[model samples]
Target: MNHQTRLQALSAFLKAQRAKILPDSVGFTSGNRRRTPGLRREEVAQLAGVSPTWYTWLEQGRDIRVSTSVLDCIATALQLTIDERKYLYALAQESGSGATLLKEQLPEISPSLKRILHELRFCPTIITDRRYYIVGWNEAASHVFLDFEQIPSEQRNMIRLLFTRKELQRLAVNWEHFTKGFLAIFRAYYGQYVEDEWYERFLDEMKAVHPDFNILWQQSDVQSAPEVLIEFRHSKAGKMLFHLTSLQVQGSTDLRCSIYTPVPDSSTEYKLKQLIERK
Candidate 1:
């Protein structure tokens, strides 16, 4: 897109985002005389610590040099999602970095990675793309988690399943805690792929169906891949606990391989064996 088009897009995005935030949500009273849906440009300027005229010029798509710090302040004022924040940066043409791979350019799983997952017979292992779509899995993963083969290609996302899949939710002993942490990592990835529209669509669809997702997303929590202990109560296997660890796939920046290892002193290993045997 050309410079003018980018500016117009940024203007529209800022307006749309500004419309989503209620004045009362950001410590302003909803006076009866309001004609707009959300906080006014002046209110946003106050929150962002920018001049009202300058902010108005930005919303008007005027040619202005937006510094990174100013963009971040505007993002904070608008309460944009990670995806929305990154898209704002892209639209403003502020990202000075070189070209990076989009999600569409994600490479296929190498044979070595496939073999590694296969050999991890006892561990429930799955490889996911930047968007948390389950792209690779082993037999253990199929048994421990729901069978990825049975899930439709579009519904193979980990966050989608976490919220929409009733069985998985019921199985997770600490569903809220686990989901929150997982969502934080997803937030990190969501911010990187500014060119991908799929992230925005997926986020909207998820928030539409799950109110909790909307609430959690608004928290704006972000974390690097952290080791987590997850406990599950399978219908057949009963109580099981596993430590989840993530590793970046070699030669691929957009792929992550996560392995679920049985926690020490837990019956998880024995239970996984039984679960796999019945599979």
Candidate 2:
């Protein structure tokens, strides 16, 4: 979407949201016979702690600048969902040119890279681009997680799977912790391409498919990929632990390889071996 189109859409979305909220919903009494069903523009501005004229101009789709803090206030006043808030930010801030650039520089994995993944016999390994798209994985990875080959190419994002895939969620021993950590890592990477159309679309799809994702996203936490001790409750192995490590591919700046090694002095190694054999 272009800048003008985004502004128009943003205007329409804000108006629609404002129309859905009743005066009583924001701590005001419905004292008089209402001319409209929802709060008026001035009333919304007051609730959001912004100047009435400023808010009016925003609703009017004037070429006005909006800060993230102000947007956060407006989101809270309007009770916008995480997805809605993200959409609002995209419409307000994204230039759309970054999407074109990103597309031109899309990451690729070679056959040798796939072979390397397969060669990691004891460790469950997977390769992803900066956007967390699952480009490749090993047999051990398939044994630990779902087989990426079985999933549609477009739906192979790690963050997407974390939210939408029930099996993965079930396997997580601490789902909330794992998801929060994952989201933080994603958020950190997203900072580099906040205005990209692909990122916007991905965020939109995630919010649409998983409402819970929005909640975590709103936290605005930033974190790099960390080597952490993670546990999973495998259906066959019962329980297993691994030390997760994320390393960037040497030549491909955008590509990252994540490996999960069994913790020392645990039955995780034996369990992983058995799991791989069963597969």
Candidate with maximal TM-score? 1
Candidate 1, lDDT over the whole model? 0.79
For all candidates in order, the CA lDDT equals 0.79, 0.78
Clashing residue pairs, backbone N/CA/C < 3 A, model 2: none
- Per-residue CA lDDT of model 1 for 1-279, tens digit only, reads 345655665787688788889898899999999998999999999999999999999999999888889989999999976656776776675352333445455457888888999899989998988778888999988887788999876668899898888888888887888788778777656544445556667787988999999887665455547688888888788888999998877663568889999998988898888878875
TM-scores vs. true structure, each candidate: 0.66, 0.63
Tens-digit lDDT track of model 2 for 237-277: 88999999988787835678889999999999999999888
Q: At residue 163, what lDDT does model 2 achieve? A: 84
Looking at candidate 1, the ten consecutive residues that score lowest on lDDT are 94-103
Question: Model 1 clash tally?
Answer: 0
